[model samples]
Target: MRISALLIDDDPILRSGMKGLLSMVAPEVEIVAEAEDVQSGIAAIEKWKPQLIFLDIQLNDGTGFDVLEHFTQSTTRLESQVVFITAHEQYAVKAFRFSALDYLLKPVDPDDLRSVIEKVKKSQDDATGISHVELLLENIKRQTNSFKRIALTNSDGIHLFEIADIIRCESEDNYTTFYIRNNKPVLVSRTLKEFEELLRDHGFVRIHQSHLINLTFLKSYVKKNGGYVIMADQTHLPISQRNKERLQELITKTL
Candidate 1:
């Protein structure tokens, strides 16, 4: 399939360079539109729903993420994937983690462009770009030891859930609900599978397809009549036969 693309950059020279690189690297890919600022970018996106977006971190009017938020809002579902082109060192590393999409440094090189194209191709096949992104973010979190809390938003506003306070992750339909400390669960619009991979190092276990519990919060294990974990909440999580052994092994090590 031919990939459609949009370019959002304030620098005319850089945007031209990226357009030229993408055209040369993947002739099949086509640039449908270009924008110089956040407002124009959003308007162009609304006009042309491209498959991929080449986002610049800094725009004339606002930051690139601000541009992203306009689409992520109710107006647009952020249908296309984003590949940020940025010079901000602080967010460059974090960018790759938040959005698994590739990024090119300032003064874009043909070699870097080629590599990013290859990564995008790989993502097109894996269909797990978001998962990989989350894993990358989790890895970053481990390395930086920053923000040991999860942010949640509901009708009232936004709330922060301490990572230590969460017992486990549970999936219902398309959302992942966090079981926290004596509080109502925080409902986020993601799957348990995603969180399971995101919190792998944080003692989360997918004992069942529908449940991902924090083994750290586990209180007791019952072995009779198929196995189940009894968490501190007194909530029982059934363990599939296939996972019983692995769960036991992890529990042993944690003890």
Candidate 2:
């Protein structure tokens, strides 16, 4: 399927570069229009109704977030898959990951751009994209360092879960199974190490190589033969010898 795309960036050179990259990597994507600022970007979006949007997070007049918020707060639903473009802002990158949104770092890499296009082609669900944007907007609106919700994509579909509701994550090779409160386990294709890094500051700790647990749902720690943690769901997960002291310190601080 041919994809119509709108490019919104303040920098002409970067826009030209993106156009060139898209042409070379994904000939199927056509640049319908281009805008250099928030208002112009919003106007182009309203006029063209493109299938995909390459949105720069920072613009002269306002940010790309302003453009998305305008449409989100209006009666029209944003149906295009949005790929956020930005310089390396650590917090912004984290927000995108938490919301399961696609992003490209500035001085965009061809491989990353191609990956985004491939994902857009595979999942053309407009609702999924809009929901991710909404989650992203909500996360940003909270004005907190910690993310309240996380979007997890499985073979079934993308599922949004409250971060606090996740009891634990069990890893099996490259797959991680999320055990949530009042929800069935969600099997995700990402490795445990990735999640550990993303969730470490949000009260999730890696007690073992295969286990990441939410401190909020931790019931107690038992130190019989070896250290183990009891989750609110009543699951017993072992704590590695190396992580036992760290877990104890965290538990002590929490108390």
Best by TM-score: 2
Top lDDT model: 2
Candidate 2 residue-wise lDDT, 1-255, digit = tens: 799999999999999999999889999999999999999999998899899999999999989889988976888778788999999988888888888888999889999999889888887764335678788888877645668899998778889999989999999999999999999999988899989988998899999999999999999899996989899999999999999999999999998
RMSD of each: 9.2, 1.9
Among all windows of ten consecutive residues in candidate 1, which has the lowest summed lDDT?
125-134
CA lDDT of each prediction against the hidden true structure: 0.71, 0.90
Model 1 has an lDDT value of 0.71
Query: Which residue runs does candidate 2 get wrong by more than 4 Å?
Result: 126-128
Native RMSD of candidate 2 (Å): 1.9
Clash totals in order: 0, 0
Q: Which lDDT tens digits does candidate 1 get at residues 72-181?
A: 34445556666778785753554353333457788888888777766666455332223333443443445443436554543443455566788977889988788898
N/CA/C clash count, model 2: 0
